[model samples]
Target: MTTKNLLVELFVEELPPKALKKLGDAFASVLCEQLRTQGLASASSVATAYASPRRLAAHVTHVRSKAQDQAVLQKLMPVSVGLTADGQATPALLKKLASLGADVSDPAAAVAALKRQGQGKAEALFYDSLVKGVTLDVGLQKALDEAIRQLPIPKVMTYQLDTDCGMPHFLPGWTSVHFVRPAHGLVALHGDTVVPVKALGLTAGNATQGHRFEAAKTPVVIAHADAYAQTLRDDGAVIASFAERRGEIARQLAARAAEVGGGCRPIEDDALLDEVTALVERPNVLVCQFEPEFLEVPQECLILTMKANQKYFPLLDAQGKLTNKFLVVSNISPADPSAVIGGNERVVRPRLADAKFFFDQDRKRPLESRVLGLAKVVYHNKLGSQGERVERVSAIARAIAQQLGGEALARQADQAALLAKADLLTDMVGEFPELQGIMGGYYARHDGLGNDIAEAIEDHYKPRFAGDELPRNPVGVCVALADKLETLVGMFGIGNLPSGDKDPFALRRHALGVVRMLIEKDLPLDLGQILATSAEVFGERVFTSGPMPSETPEGSIGIGSIGVKIDPETIPKVRDFIYDRLSGSLREQGYSAQEVDAVLALRPQRLSEVARRLAAVRTFAALPEAPALAAANKRVGNILKKADAEVQPVVRPELLKEPAETALHAALEQVASVADAAWADGDYTANLKALAALKGPVDAFFDQVMVNADDPALKANRLGLLATLHQAMNRVADLSRLAA
Candidate 1:
């Protein structure tokens, strides 16, 4: 037994900073399997991997010297065939056949071997053979080779001479060995000096480089793979951990902001810095300032320009007002840092000027005037332009508003939807794609539109992503819903439905946005009605087979699903992509997946109703006796199944003879009234609590009475009472369907 260490690094041209870590993990996983399949086992902890933009590496400690030895031989010799077709064999027969691999050619001879007499007989001879074998290093090399050969690398290239390497790899030319980018080189080290990675044309060396900036002139020597990371960090310019980088950057940004009149707080921007670290080997923070007059620009514009364009962090005052200064994290500490600050300020100047131009230009036309421009913008090639889209949205929004009985808001909603996308064609939005809706609102307000309408225009695209905020007002929710539905229906109608991971039209986002409006904002909507109205408005543009089937159809049915015909009897696929995203959004607010799934199972047509029902179920489920009550519900279901077979039955309290039956009937009546009131009030939790109360009496009634009696009348009577219980139970939820 010998302890060993193995290292394999794929050094390549600067990789996609974001995809490097994931690819490294994938490479290690793929290699680990290959090694294990070759019977290379580790005596200590399992293999581990590390990755950076330029390299992917792995190490396995305490590996066995070689796979344990074992024998390999066929065990095929039918006991019946040991003797001739007869049951016995002659003494000469055994001796004559001994030349073959058989122990005995007689049935009794084999049987006699199993039962040794008091006197011992000659011991049976054994066959010799060897199992699959490999020397440790050879096995390791073969494993590495197989892994490299089978590794999945897309868009691979080779910079060297072409060779017919015995592997079907991603690279078209040069040696079979390849990397995602050109392999800058590789180092497969075993303890010390150059462990030749000749297979990949890389020679392991003690030489490695550190920071591309500060340490650009320094070459650090590393004796082993374990020390390679440390050497790079000690001599290199930065740390590898993403958390550490973010923490350090935030600390420096805060400290710089504090040095000024105000403290700088980081605005949540979807984890941009985590990805930024992969691009820079080191980070140097500097405080930069622009003309205070620039602060007049919308806070959003300022933040976006600083972050999206220049990768600068905006500073905020103690009162949370945007300040005139910004923080820039640079990879290099310049001789005159003020030069870097000047360069960034210069780059952002045009963007701010553009914003100012749009802002000033928008003041003259007002949103009302721009509505005409959206028509020429073309919302869709088949359906129409943004102008046409605006009209359709107006119609759909008005219809939804009328449905919601918001006559005034409905009129405003229609107006908002029509004007929402108009901003897309405006100078401000044209310059900054992110300000589409906000600019529309800004223009509307400048045009003297009512605050409600302006807000609706701005809010139509609320909750742009999962966990993002929803529209602040109900009118905004209605208009936003109408706006998103119009796009989804129009695109889906035109055969431009999302295929695979490709959603060119952003329809899925629109759908999820719609779902969120319903669930989070308590907007009551019927998805089918919304989709139908949108489709009708768009006419020929709608292109789906139907509303994506809520459930797979009966046997051998052919309906397209994710680019393939769904199988008959396929369990209703819960469009998990949508639900998972929804669940994640809800989970962040402290909702559990099971609770969300339970509500989703009811196929809530309105997101608001789903939230209400989820709240109720979660509350009811917390009761200690909830499981027992659910069991009672199941029993009521069983009785109703039999009760349905007979003529229509009704609960007639006058005919009740048993006290248990009478009590159960009375309980149902009381619960029904309360449940109906709760449902009307949109208080599903109260309804669930009311229903749970029936469980105790339901159990007592079933115990004391027979559902099927000798007398047909009594059986039917009992069954009918249970049916009433079932009807009551169904109001809250089909508890039987929920997982315990």
Candidate 2:
């Protein structure tokens, strides 16, 4: 029952930087989980993962040297099959016992000891046995192999090892192994003893190499399981923990940026920080600078090139503008660091020069001229060329703008939509697709287009993700909405709807963008009308022509009309998709399921009014009479649903015989007038609250009246009164959904 911490390490060539963190977490979690499943570790055992450029390791505390033995009961088979009519063991029963490693010499005794348990319609025989515990060496070997197999490797390389000395089936020097990278060493220790585990053709040992060029000792010897981290740090001259290395780099970046003065700091990017941490064991942040003239180019282009091509953090001023100086994380530190700084600066100069060249070359020709080039770029096989998509988007944008404003806004939006995709042909955007809309704005400005058009071109792709900013100007809003609507209607029309987690066309994002624009911007436009207009713009292109007889050859031009006419029935499907996204989004914002269901049940055409109605529903639900009213509303709905014919909402005063029925009819008449006025004025909360005065009359009518009376005329009159009450209460939302 004695326990000690266990340590395991795999030393290999440098791993993929972006996948290193996930790889480390997966390895440690799976190893500890396997041990716990086998009963070698308790629920309280902790696992710590360590990952560096050349290593992946884990240390687990409270792992037992051996698991405890326990009794296991396993159902074998039905009693009818395991026993003969005379109550003797059959050949099949004996064979099953043999497979379980049970003693078959005394089959009759074993069968006698078996217990019967009911399973469905039949009784089954069960076998009980004491399972032996697994030793540390064997358990650790299995866990180690499983951990390596599940490392989340992005890509695998096949290589041959120098020797396969301990491998069971392969000859020495000829065996091949596949891994993220070539494995050179592995270390596994239980306390001070080496656990005999093998992986990637290497036998586990108690020693590993560190920091190829900076380790104090060539082979850092881990004395015991608990000493693994400290020994590696002291002798290896490396920070093995990924988080610790990242923190050190961040501290150094801050210190160096402060030394430069003028409120300068390293640009904030978590992904860049993680990649830098994965690239070095010993981080030395050094400040480097390039010629200040490069600043004339757009800072976005320069910043993106530095971070993507060189993995360097570009410095920025207090005003959030890029500065000339940048920070580079070196893998080693020297007494005089000028050489490393100069080398990094020298390497970055060419990358900056290339970005400047692309920007300059892109500006020579106006963005408007590139519109013709997009015809060669395929947007999708079924959707035809980007040129065709641009035409559809431009038409939709103008229609939306005309509805929102007048001729001026419509003209600006149309021009912006026409030029938005033109940037795809520019040298700058060709090099970096992330800079497409951004570069369009710059190039349009350079071409002497007004600020409205330039800004619209840039902001049309705004709110690309959740919580991202919306377009800043009205023209931009029109184009953004049009762009998203075009995608949604076109895809859904062609039967390309998103299936669980598999939206290749990003239809869900497009739908959410439309919802945000309509609801958050309060655009006062009808979603169904917009979808219909966009579908018309697509015309015959929305239909699928089955599969293409053959794909257009690469670099081929003028591949004529591939799409047929669209199915008109898809318009409602597209509208419903947008509403589904809205429902999910509102629920995620902290509304209860019942509240959301009630508000969304109406499927209001004006999305901007939804929030008002939901607020009104919430306010009404808080009233003292809400439960009784909600229950009465539910009862009324069920009563109307069971009627043989459609019940009219007209209640004749002469037919109201019961005092309770007459009282309820009078109360509804008085309340409905007030609620109707509030609803007409868009005071939804006041309207729903005004209906709360009918709770007493509603409850009393339901308590004293028999809705299904013997006389058909009386029954119809009662149904009419209930229908009138149902309509008044459910104007804002379906209150019955709020009932428990």
Candidate 3:
């Protein structure tokens, strides 16, 4: 058996750490799928991808030299031009034909068209366009070229443009190769001799280098990808393995921390570690010490300042207490790391001093004292000021607390919500934006409001990203939900909703945060009511914007701020935007688009409740007969959809006649009884099954009987029966929206 290997590499300027893994995995998976779809065979390996700040590479072994060609057919749908009655292509059709590359002006082409052949069969039309008939064992080189050409990267430029100029890629226009990074060169060598990699206008060689300072040059020639990686490592740098880098760093960190009478715990920053590892060919962990006085500043401020700003890992003692020392993973082994440690400590000292100043200033006047200052800080001119939002949040939180029945915590939640945004205007939060909620919690604790209030202040921003933690305490949950709701209402009030990847306000994050708290924390607060109250706060702003210039009250104050008069129509529009956010949020949890429609049809007041009903229906949908039941639902749905097409019919039992109609009616009655009992008990699965049982009878009734009969009395009876089915079904879901 013959064997071939494929290798691709890219070298470029340093990439943003965030785009590394995603770009690496995308190139490999997209290329692999494209290859298989194009009929390449005997490919049984994953393309091993390696990514760094400046380079990305992929290696595929056991690659076939040729692709297994298969026939593909295309269809020529009827053109808009008229055809002759005898099924001949007409003069008008021929006149417009040249637009599609048909040489209709030629006598032979016109004659063939006038004769009319090769109609109806999709394959025949496509086959005629092919320059050659389907042949076996087509060259794999062409397939690889085609696949790579189609890989979509958000940004690309071409160094060398091919003859067929498509959209310019995210690389140099003259560069006729596709690479996620710069392709310094390709190396397709076999032993000492170089193998040709000229298929896509690329040539391979046998030269590589190691770390610049340690081993800048190597006199080795690599024949294969595996050997190439090993040779580089043998020279001085460990190449090709992220696991090895992580292990080396962890080992050094552990031994160093042990010397300090403690051990380094891994921070929850895999992304940071990955980028740091890529910065060096060899990773050496160095533990650096700082003055313990910095510990007086909030741990979050110190840790975030170190990790987010400096890319350093903070250390912890055996008891999980924060230590004055931190671990800095370096690319090169420094001769005097004490200098490195001292440099980092000096940089961090000023940051902590800023934190200390904010803490001391904030405590001198409690967070509540600063709440009035937020009134001058406008959140959105149309949505009211920051102080107004705080009041709205307080109301929303208290209502949520009342719903959860934490009277005392609910009151504390109201106070916490009012004070939450007060930290936004603080000096510390201005420097470290991520520490907004954390600092609020710290200041609250310093004021002796205790842990619950302090936690509520911090927990309000519990989930800053997907899969992040949600508020665990009830007060925290209320405050968090309130905070997100206020932001959503305010931003949407100003018509600043996210549009096509442009979200200046981070509304998507706020919406998702609301979803996480509702679903993960299982907060039972209704979103509809909360939005209504918040909307009222906005509505007042709208009304105060002044009604259409009226004759009365001519001397009254004119209402307009930041050039927008908050009109009545804007409130419902903003509310609909919130609903859209809710539907999208629920869609991420594996709910079908139709399921989202069904649950949303119920006019959900609370986002958490909306998620619950959707979850219940989703679980119920997985039962053995779910699809069949959904099919049955479609039948009942059709009858009801048509019946209620004009108006929703109220079931009037008096107009009953046909046995089939009566039987379906009685079955619906029994189902309704079960549905009510289950719905009241919150057993939606049982309710859905009970509703599903009506599908068989519904199908039979629809087949055996007609609803729009000649007799008016009998027609009303049948319509009433369909209406009864609709009412029973709506209890579980708006099955009328179910797909056929």
C-alpha root-mean-square deviation, each candidate? 8.8, 3.5, 8.7
Off by over 4 Å in 1: 2-7, 25-53, 58-154, 162-178, 210-220, 233-255, 258-261, 266-270, 319-324, 348-364, 399-405, 487-512, 523-629, 635-649, 652-720, 738-740
Q: TM-score for all predictions?
A: 0.74, 0.92, 0.72
Q: After superposition, how far is residue 319 of candidate 2 from its true place, in Å?
A: 0.5
Candidate with the greatest TM-score versus the true structure: 2
Residues 1-740, model 1: lDDT tens digits: 55456666666667776665566666666666666666665434366765655666666655555677766543323334333445465444455445434466454655454322122233222223356556556775676676666655656665663344333553546445455676645566555534544456554555655666676436656567566566667875545444455567767766777777545565555456655655665677888788888777678777876787777778887777888787888878878898888888888788778777767876776666777765445344355456666777888889888887668768778777777887776777777899878877777887888788888888888868766788877678778877887766655444576778998877678768877777665656776566667666754333223222223365544233222221221112213334555666677778776676666655655556666777787888888767887777766666666554853447767768888888988888887888899888978888888877777787788789877787878877777777667666656556655545
503-532 per-residue lDDT for model 2 (tens digits) = 998888888988898889998998888888
Number of the top-ranking candidate, with lDDT as the measure: 2
Candidate 2, number of clashes: 0
How many clashes (backbone atoms < 3 Å, residues ≥3 apart in a chain or on different chains) does model 1 have?
14
Q: How would you encode candidate 3's per-residue C-alpha lDDT over 1-740 as one tens digit per residue?
A: 35455554444455456666566555556545554555442457556666555545555665554454343333333432344445456565555455545576564454354322355632122213322322112433343454456545556644453434333442445556545444444454323335444433444566654565665456334556657567667763645454566667767767777777755464657777766766656777887777898788778878888887778888887777779888887776778778877777788777778778877776787887888888766565456567777888888788778778668867888888888888888888888888888888888887888788888898888677777888768889888877777777766666776889898887788877876676666666666566666656544443223333332266876466344334456556655766677788777767899889978877665555665577667776666656665665566566656763543555566666556666787788887888889889978777777766676677678778877888876776676676666667777566556544
lDDT assessment of candidate 2: 0.89
